[model samples]
Target chain A: MTAETQVREPLTLKRVGRFVADNPLIPLVVLLLLLVGVLEFMRPGIVNERWIGNTIKFAIPLAMLAACQTMTMLTGGIDLSAAVAATISAFVMATQVPIVGVPLAICIGLLPAILMGLVNGFGVAVCRVHPLIMTLGTGLIATGCLQVYQRFVIASGSVVPDGLAWLGTGRTWGLPNSLLLFVPMAVLIIWAQRRTGFGRLLYALGSNETASRISGVRPWQVFLALYALSGLIAGVTGLLYVGLIKAPSLSLVNPLLLPSVAAAVIGGTSIFGGRGGYGGTILGALILTVLGTLLTLLQMPEGARRILFGLIILTVTTIYIRLTEQSR
Target chain B: MSRLITKHGWTAGLLSILVLLFILTRMIQPEFGASGLDSLSRATLPFAFATAAMAVVVIAGGIDLSVASMMAVAGVTAAVLMDGAGDGMTVVAVIVVLLIGLAMGAINGALIVLTRVPDIVVTLAMLYVWEGVALLILNAPGGAATPWLRQLIVGPFLVPWLPKSFVFLVVCVALIWVPLKRSKLGLSIYAIGSDELAAYRSGVAVGRTRIAAYAVCGLFAALGGLTLTLSTGNGEPIPGPYLMASVSAVVLGGVVLGGGKGAILGPIIAVIILRLVRMDLTLMSVDPNVTTIVEGTIMVVVVMFGGVIAYRGRQK
Candidate 1:
């Protein structure tokens, strides 16, 4: 109400705003830390080294999928087929791992995923189809292909070798083995999003396709690469799932679909595109993982946990929209 | 008629496909006579309603991903509440279910307008919330609807063997579609889809209209849920395959995913086409595994076909 008070108050708020904009992940990290603090106080056992390590392990696959979602979302496109692509990749790996060693089997497994991504990208970029429908179509195709493959190619098998257990549920130096892939993948994804020409293309295309086109940006080629990148990431995420879950089932990837999108959205990635980085998404994935752990600790119904995820996405999106809208 | 055809090309195309598929299917398995057609109509009824619901939201330049969960909640609400109640309460159950659905939709519309978040995200979140609530209400999916209530919707309404559900569908479409298409709000809805800023500048109540779009969508989604409950004779808490099926039906009907075009009839016919494809496959003894492939292929083809149409127009 007073001039001096109002001016000073806004100055303080401005400093806070600048801080948040400079490091969007700060709020998420604070939230994660606060959550951990509260959970530790409530249960006293949640902060142990083993639990923390295992939670990160559980989050690794989701974080990987979030990378896929985040990259696609950056380009104002989405990949509904990513989870299914991963499933397809895992299917190939599961069936072929015994015949071909792990490395060769992994390469063969990723081929289908890359092809699926190529189709999704082609449909979205060249054909000018909406990304939602394109991904949906490819997702269905992936599911159908899996069914057909099972019906004909290899009906029986998919036993995980004991050797892979160390990679999956094993630990090294008091940390999750899966962290090796996740930590580097996160760093690489963030770097690509920030430092790469392809990353700039995504931002430009998402922000204003028409202007980008007039500036000599070939949207088709960029979208093709972006979608293919997402597909490729999705395959890697799928292979990671084999490490986590130890076997491949058709329904394995179903639950991961929406959560991946939620992670990116919660991590301050604009669904409208042209904004966001992996730093926030890492925290987003961790937040969800911790929330699940807490809910399970509290014996909450699975349904309630799902609803909580929805509300969390809604709440975070609203805040980010408010934040960005105010800034603009 | 020609003008109508030109105006509603998607509807015309869908009708042709439906008619052709029907004739071919009945021919393939002569055992699938009038009864087969009747059953197919019955099978397609729920999806038709769901597609109709989606059409309203999509026409308003919005998307509603919560269709499956909304339907599930409605069906569960009706079945769980009406299980032991006498015949008279069936009406109450229907009314309550419909109101619940409208409220759920209102909640979605409210979140979107008040927060101004994207419709897809809001609806996607609602999808999750509603799915959770539905599963919570009846975890194992065992609830009952009275026989009379099922008969009321599915049994004879006017002429015997004509299928009351079909008549009800026609009536519902005429009631919503005709009036909605004629109203100023209808034009404004399409205007919003074509260009939100222009529509808003021209004095359209964007926020209010969107809420109404979603609310009306809720009504039809609930109706669709009721239809499913009656046919199944019980409640299904899980969203099941209805989500993808409805989405496929709507897209195949030529309703643009970005909204602003297409009609209720197009989606209705598309639903029949989908169900018929499965029915045809079943009768011909072909593998059902190909059904998902066919559905997916149809979605991609239909959307691509729209692109082609637009391209040709642009060239001209």
Candidate 2:
């Protein structure tokens, strides 16, 4: 890794610069502020309480998906299989609800995601496979199996079952029901990292797997748990999306994968692993969602939208990397 | 020499896998013997080229998610440019697409080095950029590659029985792979991939070698695109299944994803194995999805098997 050098600056100036750079989420907050302010300016009253609520509603699934990315990245790996897992989970939930009922169907749907995550973990940890190919293969497997499932079992329809709508799109006291889910999940994730031994173990595993292995850390077990959590979170996101869209498709969550990774990275989590938190990812998710709305409001085409997203991810991640990387 | 051969445990393993797949293919599809082999090779050509393209970047300790997009850009660019060109424009069109690929790869490499960003971050962005660019250049994919250009990939110059796909692989191994592997720069590439700090300390031109690797990868990607265009006689924007497919094949071939290990022959053979697997699946009247499932399983298994190998290798 290269540590960029800059010319000397006065004491206070340097301190502020360093502070802004050190916190990955700080820049994101600035960006989020600027975006909301602009949106309000462009369309009067667009940035009201309702707007915030809607933004959060739109943001819930992305935040949940990004949370999965953060967990995987914390271990110095990634789960490219995330979107596929979420899609499969959603597909299952959609197809099974008629036969098994909503509750049982949801449980059954999440099982495949767990299995996929377990395979990814095994491949990365025990098989010593690189995470990129390992997760990608698992993703391919998930997609393939889903297609077969669709063909042989039941054809999934566009409409999400009525029973599934409440958790995804239900409102409570002017707040989205998904917000209820997001808050606890976010709190639990943050608590797990800050309070639990497993969280520390995850960071340690990413910090130096060989050292961790020698130190009796059982890297594989950690990987297994971390990845399983990733899958579970992805499953939750899939279910939420089905409720939000009212229609479940294999690609329902595909677009979310990149943004989720971007959101986590924008929040300051290192792709190399173990040095960031959920706070940054949450902000990152909000920024991405707001940016997305901004783009749609501007009527940018799909090509341009992708270009902007790509650029934002590149620029933000690099700045975060360069800034914090130098100090660490 | 024997020690050297043994050192490439992964490559030897891949070769055996290839042989096993070949025998199975021969046994299962006896009609696919001499006569049917040409079409099989033809169908596998684009992916085979793509796997090789991706292997180069993976070996350099970087990843390029934009492989298929680059191919798409190359294909569509060629078709769009040569659609109704005047005399001798075909050669110009080929060169242009190839250069476009090199430029795209260079951007990926440059961003990675200059920004000090992780390769995945940079390349991930580039994937979108290239795909977006492909969309911009040819929004709906409605162009035809030049007639002679399509023939060139198959090489009317070669023996009638031999597909241009196999011929291209042979040419690359002989011309590019063999020489590059033994060159001083190759050692530098391996060194940089294994440990950048150590490689830099050892006086390797890490940045340049990394850039060169992407350039060659870009070249191969362009070749892949041209091959696709030639095979289909038309261009398509969404040509990324090959990128994922290549990643799967690379893992199957046992090429260490972060570079510094594995032989060129590995992915080349692994591509064949995957195509054979797909062939077998199709012949059995299995849904196309099953092929993807089996490919994914094979990749998972190979990756898992690799973990054991690495563990035992570490102990030794």
Q: How much is B195 displaced in model 2, in angstroms?
A: 2.1
Once fitted onto the true fold, the runs of candidate 2 whose alpha carbons sit more than 4 angstroms away are A1-13, A155-159, A326-328, B4-9, B154-158, B172-174
List A-chain TM-scores for all predictions: 0.94, 0.92
Per residue, candidate 2 scores C-alpha lDDT tens digits across B1-316 of 8897778766787778777876877777776664456667777888987888888888888888889888988988887888877548888888898898888788788888899888877877777777777787777867887776566555423566676667766785568777887999778878887888999999999999899888878888988888788788877877658988888777777678778877667787888888878887887778898888888888778677777877798989
Stretches of candidate 1 off by over 4 Å are A1-15, A153-155, A161-164, B153-161
Clashing pairs in 1: none
Which digits, one per residue and each the tens of the lDDT, describe model 1 over residues A189-294?
Answer: 8888799988888899988998999999999898888888888999988887877798688767779888888888889888888888788888888988887777
| Candidates' RMSD to native | 1.9, 3.3
lDDT of 2 by residue, A1-328 (tens): 1232334344445565578766656777888899899888888888877778889998989888998888888888888889888998888988887777777888999999998888887777777777877888889888988988887555544346675588777787878888878899999999999889988888888888888889999887888888888988898889888888887776889988877887888888888996788888999899989988887888766677767768877997887676665543
Full-model lDDT for every candidate:
0.82, 0.81
Q: Which candidate comes out best when scored by lDDT?
A: 1
Query: Which run of 10 residues does model 1 chain A get worst, by summed lDDT?
Result: A159-168
Query: For model 1, how does the per-residue alpha-carbon lDDT over B1-316 read when each residue is reduced to its tens digit?
Result: 8997788877887888888987898689877665665677778888888888888888788888899899998988888988888877888898999999889888888898999888878988889899988888888777898987677666555655576778778897788778988999788878787788888999999888888888888888899888888888888988857777777787888777777887677888888888888888888887777877877887777777676677678769
